[model samples]
Every structure is written in C-alpha cells, then in structure tokens.
Target: MRENEGGQERPGGEVEEPFGFWRGGGAHERVATGFEETPFGEVWERFLESVDTTNVGALTIGYWGADYDTHFVYPVPLLVEAAASFPNLRSIFLGDIEAGQSEISWINHGDITPLLEAFPALERLKVRGADGLVLEPVKHESLRVLRFESGGLPAGVVRAVAGSDLPKLADLGLWLGDEAYGGDSAVDDLAPILSGERLPSLRHLALDDSQFQDEIAEAVASAPVVARLATLSLAMGTLTDRGAEALLSGQPLTHLRKLDLSYHYLSEPMMARVCAALPGVEVDLDDQQEPDEGEFYVEVAE
Candidate 1:
C-alpha cells in the first residue's frame, strides 16, 4: 500500500507537525523530519539545535534520501546516540516515507532493537515498511503500544515480538502481508501471541493485511487470547465466507466491544449474519472487495 500523508496523529492525542530546519517560534509536542540531498546526520544535528527536544514527546522519521533503499543503516545509530536529548520522548514512528519517495515494500530498514534498548521508558512504537527489517527479542516494561505496517512483514520479526517480554503492553497490531515480498509467516508462528502467554495486559490486537486471512481467521476463532481482548481486528485481508463461518461457529465474541472486518471479501449474507450476531458490538464491514478472475486479494500487498 502507498502512504500519501504524514503522521497526523500520535499517541496520547498529540498533533504532529513537519520539522522546520529554520527554528520556529513555538515548540511542538510531536514533529516529523526527512531529508532529500543532505546527510541524515546533518539534518538530525540541525533538528537538535533548532528544536527544543526536551519538550518533544513524540517523533516521526520520514524519508532519508534518494538512496534510502541502499543506504539505510545510519538513522538508528543517530537516534540511539541522541536518546539523552529526548528525556520526555515516549512515542516514535519510523519509516514514515510515503509512496512518492518509496513504496512500502521498497523502504529499507535495519535492526530496530537498539531503539527499544536505548529508550527504556518509551511507550509507543509504530513502524512502516519491512524490507531488511530486524527486531530482536527484547524485554521492556514501559512499552504499551506496538504496531507494524508493511506489505510483507517477516516471520522473524513476528516471532521476536511474540517472544519478547512486555508485561505492560496493551495494544499490538501486525500486518502479516503477502509472501511475495517477505511475509512468510504461517499461522503456527502466531501461537504464542494467540495463546496470550507473553502479553498479559493486551486488550487490543490486530492481525491484518494477510494473504492467508482465512487460515488466520480460523485460528483466531478459538484462540484463548480472544476472551481477554476488548477489540480485535482482522481487517485489510482476503477474509471470505469460510473465515466468517469459522468465526460464527467458534467461541462467543460477545465480550468484545468492537470487531473490525473492513476491506474484506465476505458476502452480503455473511456480513448480515456477523452484524446480527454481534448486536451489541460495533462491527466495521466497510470496503467490501470482489474477486478478480476467481482470485481474492489482500488490500496492502505490493
């Protein structure tokens, strides 16, 4: 999927603005920055000098340069080294590059484990793009929200997240995209998460944008984690009548406040049944899709 806009909203309801190289008059809670020709270091240094980073609670990293697909190893180190400057930093959005700069599958990323290591008090982390992305298993107590938006999320990253220890984490969103890019994860890979053994405080969970949406839906139907979650999302995938049937036949989802099945391939009767079944729940059935030559497709695959 092609992202056209920048991060407009952040955790804790903060508005984000584009980082200005020339020192602006007022301070902002959240800011986004990117570079075209200048080195990332220079832009970062200038941002530090110009903006009062101590007051900044959220930061968004945008396009690095024209050669971002090739040269993608510098930004992580710079952020880790400058962690001391952002004492109040809690939320960070990496790889905010849009479709004009680079496609979601083409945006290159490096090991992001150091960021979690450096920022022990960080609460929210959202990353876009998944090419060459790596996230080693880490233990952090303060993290509350973690989301990954990708056309193809690697199985290694998913396993690492499942293995990691985050006792206080409450929200998790994973886009298990198409296998053609790098999303080779099977339904078995998510057993730990579906079991709810590692994430004790999780209330909101999203397993979205997958080619194997039907299999995931079947697995999720009886997952133990469903009982504890307040909201569950299976949106932006190739979910059809079979997956809906599995959900309807499985454990009662009446406890959940919301069920998101947007951008799906479900039939009209199935959609009606879902809504009728979950009368008290707010079900999102927007963006209904149709098959192309008997082939159903996920929403965000490249």
Candidate 2:
C-alpha cells in the first residue's frame, strides 16, 4: 500500500495517468505521459505534437523506460527544453513509476534543479526515489508544495530543501525511510525546518516513513514549526507507544485541524489516548501495526 501506483493529488485536481498521448481532443489539464519500449525522445516529440502542452496545468512523468537508472536523467533536460510549451505548468510529479515497473528505492534519479530553474511559475513539485539524486538549495518564490516520495531519502537532499529559500512554500512532505537504503539523514539535519526559520508560509508538514520515527516524533513534539502547521503527519513509520506518549505530553495540539498518524505501531490504549486528547482535531489512526518480536520495520524500505 505504501508503494505508490496511481497518480497523486495536486492543488488543481487528481493527476490523470493516461496510457499514451491523446489522439484528438481529450482533457489535458492534469495528465501523465509515459512510454515503455520506445525511446523517450520520440515520446516527447509525439506528446508535443499531440497535445497542447501550454494548457496542461499539472504533469506527471511515469515509467520512462526499462533502464531507469540511466534513462531517469533524460527527463529534466527534455522538460527544460520544452519549457515554453508548458507555459501553464504549475505542478509536476517526477518518477511516477509504479512498483511493477521499478521498486521505489531502485528508481535512480538526477539533479532536478533545471526543472525548477526553467519553470519559475511552478507551484508544486513531487519527486519519487532518491538514488543518485542531487539538489542544490535554490530560492524559489512560487513553490507552495514540495514533496519527495522515497523508501530511502538522502540526507543531502533533506539539507538542500531545508537550506532553500521558499517564501511561499506551504506543504512539505519528506519520506525519510530506513538508513539501510541510503536514508542517512538524522534529526539534526532537520533543525532548520523544525525551527520554522526558512519556511514562513509552511502550514502542512509531513516527516513520515522513517526508521527513527520515535526520535522524529520526540523532536516534532516541541518543534517550533508544529505551532504553525494546520496538519501534521508522522505516519508510514514504526511509531510505537513511546512516540505517541511524546506527542501527548508535548505542547497542546488542540490548535491543529488534523493529525495524521496512520501506519503506526501504537498500543490500543495509546490510540485511545490520542483520540481523546484531540477531540476537535480529525486524527487519522488507520493502518495499525504490531512490532515483530522487539524489532520494528518501516512501511517502505527496499
């Protein structure tokens, strides 16, 4: 369930994952264009020919080819070259490949700064996978939602995002997965984000799918950023009663509109306590998990 197969929801609407380019007149508002055996360059050329890319609001790049490790590097430049064609491009989802095409951890990625540099008006960006991923902190004014979906997100990427100057960023989601798969970021790397110094407009925050969910929860309990967030998500990790207790004992969360703690390892009593503590808040306690012996596992770690 953690491995994403369908397209994600954007500010405009749900992303449309059409198998191929539209033949004549189909809604190209929020669409995903992809190919399997054919070269991506050819697909790109055909896509430009088929659809009026200028009117497309949101785009998702799904399953480029068989050899994604090398093929993954091609999308950025192609998109950059075709930047003029997508004048209305506001949101983009890179590496939207399903589990059947490639595992989340195995989807090799490259530097995506060019895409941001090209589309200055882009408001949202969501990327999947972290292997070979590179991002240097750059100031972006229009970006409101930035999410990185990974079974193992790199510390460098986390640092880069924290260091970036995003004045209008409202939603930030980072899936800090198991360290075994290259998720090397510690809580210290998240100090800038937790301090709420760089992200002035951040309202919805998700620091999910980590091996050290408890430690992250402990930090988030007292984080200055928590005070500003309307919705806080610490889901898809191995959160036990220990982490839940920290949240309960931390600053009052009655101000928040929603608290997402799905896919957790909390005891029944702790779950009840969380629900009772925030009667006004919409708390999501779905996908309860039990620890195996004394060890715990994250939802997605390849």
**Residue pairs in steric clash, candidate 1?**
none
The C-alpha stretches of model 2 lying farther than 4 A from their native spots are 1-36, 66-73
Of candidate 2, the 10-residue stretch with the lowest lDDT total is 17-26
Clashes of each: 0, 0
The candidate that wins on lDDT is: 1
Q: CA lDDT, every prediction? A: 0.83, 0.82
lDDT of 1 by residue, 1-302 (tens): 52322333445886433222212222334333354456666677788898888877778788765443343344777899989998888788787777877788887788999999999988888898898899999999999888899999999999999999999988899999999989989999899999998999998899999988889899999999999987899999999999999999999999887898999999999999999999999899999999999988778876
| lDDT computed for candidate 2 | 0.82
lDDT of 2 by residue, 140-219 (tens): 99998898989889999999999999999988999999899989999888989999999999988899999889988999
TM-score against native, each model:
0.88, 0.87
The window of 10 residues in a row where model 1 has the poorest summed lDDT is: 17-26
RMSD of 2: 4.8
The residue ranges of model 1 lying beyond 4 angstroms of the native Cα positions read: 1-36, 66-73
